[model samples]
Target: MVYQGNDPKSNDNYRAVFGASSAPFVTLLEELPDEKRNLRYSLFCDNLFTSFHLLAHFKQLGYEVTDTMRENRIPKNCPIAMKKKNRGSRIFIRP
Candidate 1:
């Protein structure tokens, strides 16, 4: 596992590679050994690492991804019901 320092200088390589958006998560996945990286894998992550862009990126790479996402991270155009309106319910969105 990689340790990320709070200071900006310590994360320069991560920033350079991923630019922005869930770099820590992306870094871990990308750093997998070649055999693991080439095989299809299911990735499960928490809200802190979940975003529409990250989901799409892994989906395109043939990995099955599942995660809990913050309400704010939901795309504005998505039709999922608001959390308050559908407590304990499951909502699925397909692209």
Candidate 2:
């Protein structure tokens, strides 16, 4: 997907490639604009894409990475580990 700016002079190119899995995502990234291509950006993906290589690439590009561990599926990697943590039914964190 691309977001077009209002003015031609202020226009920027943005692209998003959706895939069934991150394995393909990595492959797709190889085809995208690289840091040497003079582009600065970030990545927003699901937990299925939370891998060391992926993070490294985004970090190299000076891009902030955001990935949620829980989104109706099991997470492959979690920055915030859920292991040994208790899951209560009626507890919510929003204050």
Candidate 3:
């Protein structure tokens, strides 16, 4: 989806994509319906969006989010493997 600077309500762009240097998910989340914003939902996002900040933001926005992380985004001491022996297991650490 493209970011429409002057008209955010629509994803259509006149030409160029102009937006704040923000997580792409942040821009997408901003378009949520007001009431649904407070409802809990399971969200699946790409690796580019998997970060502590995004996780916290998703939680605050009432989402149970799932995503894989790049090693650097994780703290050195935290072992993601030990937390899960297989897929679908999640560890939520409060920032």
Candidate 4:
């Protein structure tokens, strides 16, 4: 499930995950009878999270995830780009 929260000091946008645990998702899932726990779900999260434990838990439960990263943890061969339309109408591919 997706819900919005805020940083206490700056009031920045924050998203919370509640799955297989928590009051709301638990309540919702509990209402559904005979539901299989093997079902897979996808989640997108920011790199602000330091631990991979939660994501590993999801993987153990057969779920898939696509995470956005703020850290330079990926390999060098990975393509990283920032689009700037104001620069030009040309397309340049760099290695």
Which candidate wins on TM-score?
1
After superposition, candidate 1 runs with Cα above 4 Å error: 1-21, 84-86, 93-95
Encode model 2's per-residue lDDT on 30-80: one tens digit a residue. Answer: 556655444665667767656545565667756666665443454456444
Every model: Cα RMSD to truth: 3.7, 10.6, 6.9, 10.6
lDDT of each: 0.72, 0.49, 0.60, 0.42
Which window of ten consecutive residues has the lowest lDDT sum in model 1? 2-11
Native-structure RMSD, model 3: 6.9
lDDT of 4 by residue, 9-88 (tens): 32112124432222232233334445555466554555554224445555665656666543354445645553444553
Please, what is the TM-score per model?
0.70, 0.42, 0.57, 0.36
- Please state the error at residue 13 of candidate 4 in Å: 24
How do the residues 22-57 of candidate 3 rate in per-residue lDDT, one tens digit apiece?
A: 344576666678886667778876666576666776
Extract clashing residue pairs from model 3: none
lDDT minimum window of 10 residues, candidate 4 = 6-15
**Residue ranges of candidate 4 with Cα displaced over 4 Å:** 4-37, 72-95
**Tens digits of per-residue lDDT for model 1, 11-55:** 566555534557767667777898988898888778877887788
Off by over 4 Å in 2: 1-20, 33-37, 70-95
Q: Report the number of clashing residue pairs per model.
A: 0, 0, 0, 0
3 against 4, candidate with superior lDDT: 3
